[model samples]
Target: MERSYPRDPEWEAMPDVGLEVWPHSPPDTAAYGEARAQALQAPEVEKPFSENLANEALDIPRSQERALSYRVSALMASLARLNHCDDEPTQADMRLIQEQRMLVAMQLAGSPSLQQRLTNPAWVADCWSDALASLGAIGVRVENLPEDCPWDQDALLDGPQPNGRNR
Candidate 1:
C-alpha cells in the first residue's frame, strides 16, 4: 500500500539541505485525480444530488474532526493487535504504521512549539521565500502560503496533507 508522488525534474535538481523534504508532486494528486477529472466533466445541473449535498454536509471543522477520529481508531486497533506481537510486522502492518506516522506529523505541524520553530525569524528569513517558490513551481497554489508570520492554528493546519502517502 506504499505510495509515492509523481516524479518531477525540478524536485530532483533542488539540493536536499534538510530544511524541508519537498514532495515530488502535490500530495494525494494521483489518488483523487480521477475524481477531480470527473467533477470537471459533470456540469453542476447534471451532477448527482448526493454529490452536491455531500459538499455542504461537511465543512472544514467537521472534516478535521472526522479525520482525527479515524486516525485514533486505526491507532487503537494497531496497538491492540501489536500487544501480543512477537515477530516483524507484515507489509500491511508497516503501511498502517507509516500512515499513522504521517497523520501524526501533520497533526504536530499545528502544535505551538513546531509552529514557533517554523516561524522563527532566523530560519524563516532564510528559507520562507525559497520554500514558497519551490511549492509554486510544482503547481501548488501560492494561495496556500500564509499571509504573515506566526500563522494562526487554522492556517497552519489548513494546507495540503500527505493523505497516508508513505513519502
Candidate 2:
C-alpha cells in the first residue's frame, strides 16, 4: 500500500509559473547621476537672524495662541479651586497643577521673547503675583496654599505693588 500526504487545495489550485518580465525598462543611470550632481551643486541659502526670528514668530498660528490662553485660564481655575479648599490638596490636584505649569512653561518657551522674559526672576515673580491677584479678584481665597507654591504668601495676601513687587 502507498503512503498518502495531505495537500493544500488552495495551493494546488494556483496557476503554474512562467518566465517573469518587467513592465518597464530600468532607470537611466546617467540621468539619475546628472540630477543628483545638479542637486549637490545647488547653493544653500542661510536666512538672516531677523528673518529667522520673524519666521519663528510667525510659525505659531493665532489659533495656537488662543489655545494657550484657554489653557492658562483653565490653569487659573484649577489653582483657584485648589487654593479655596480648606482641606489639604490631593495628590491628583498637585499633579494637575504641576502638569498645567509644565504645559504653560513649554508653550511660553516656544517664543524667544517669552524665554528671555522667563530668565528674569522679577518678571516671573510679578507673573505669579498677577495670577494670584486674578484668582483673588474672582473671589477665590488665596489661602491654604501648597508648601511648594511659587508666589510669596505675604506678597500675595497684600496684593502686588505698583512696581510689580510684593509689598
Candidate 3:
C-alpha cells in the first residue's frame, strides 16, 4: 500500500499572484473614515527661503505678465532637463532646486493670487537668471555608460569544483 497526501484541486489550479494574500478583517469603518479625513485636513507647509526670494521677485508688478509666465515655464523645463541628465548635485542642493521649481510652477499653473503678484519684469528676470546660474554652477559632467558591464566580464562557471570539492 502507498501513502497519499490530500490537496485541494481548485487551489492547485489557481494562478500564481507571486505574493501571499492573507485573510484579514474588514477595516474598522469609523477608524478608516477618520484616517482619510485627517489626511485631507493636513495643512500646507511653509515655503523655504529660496522660494520666498523667488516669490518676492515674482510679486513685483510689471507690464509684461505673459512674458514672465513664459520665463517661469522655461525655468521649470530647464530644471527637469538638469535632473534627468545626471548632473549630480548634493542632496541638499537638489532639494532646494526642486522646492523652488515646484513653487514657481504652482504659482504659474493655478494660483491666481500668486500669478497676480509675479508680474514685475526685473524681478522675474533676476529670479530665473539667479536660479539658472546656481544650477549651472553645481552641474557635474555626465559620463557615458560602459558598453560591457563589470558583471558581464566574468565567465560563467560550468559544472563543478576542481581539487576534490565535488558536491
Candidate 4:
C-alpha cells in the first residue's frame, strides 16, 4: 500500500501569481563575426589635431630638461661612490644614497622624456664618465684637507644669523 502526501488546501486554491518568463534564444554569432571582420579591414586613421597638441604638451621644457640632467648626474655620482668606496658606508651615507635613488626613480616614473634619455647608451656612458670625474675631483680636494683643522662655522656664515645678529 502506498501512502499519499497531503497538500495545503488554501495554497492549492490560491491563484498562481508568478512573473511572466521570456524564452532566450542564442545570439547571432554570424553577424558579430561579420562586423568584427569589417572593423579589422578598416583603414588606420590619423590622430586628431587636439590629441597631437596634447602629446606635444607632454614634452619637457629646455630649462627643466637641464635640471633633470643635473639631478640624474648627482644620483649617478652618489651610486658610483657607494659602489667604489673602500671603507664601509656609514648610516648617513647609505640614507643619502637611498634617497637619491628614490628621487630619480620617482622622477623617471613621471617623465617619459627622461625615460627616453636613459634608453640611449651613449648618453648614459657620458653621464657616468662625468659623474666619475666629478667624484674624483671632490675626492682629491677632500684628501688634501688637514684632519686636525677646526671648522669655523662663523666664518662660513655670510649673512645674518638666525638669532637676528649680522655675521
Q: How accurate locally, in lDDT, is each candidate?
A: 0.44, 0.49, 0.40, 0.48
Error of 3 at 91 (Å): 18
- The best-first sequence of candidates by lDDT reads 2, 4, 1, 3
Candidate 3 collision pairs: 58-118, 59-117, 62-119
Tell me the lDDT of model 1 at 84: 26
Tens-digit lDDT string for candidate 3 (1-167): 99898999999999877344322322332233333344434454334644554344333322234444555545533443344454354566555445555555554443333343345555444544544454455662213211121111011011111121111
Q: Measured by TM-score, how close is model 4 to the native structure?
A: 0.44
In each prediction, how many residue pairs overlap at the backbone (N, C-alpha, C within less than 3 A)?
A: 0, 0, 3, 0
How does candidate 2 fare on TM-score? 0.35
Candidate 2 residue pairs in clash (backbone atoms < 3 Å): none
User: Which candidate would rank higher by TM-score, 1 or 3?
Assistant: 1
lDDT of 2 at 66: 45
Which candidate number has the best lDDT?
2
* Model 1 spans with C-alpha error above 4 angstroms: 1-58, 85-88, 107-167
RMSD of each: 21.4, 17.4, 24.2, 22.4
Best by TM-score: 4
Model 4 has an lDDT value of 0.48
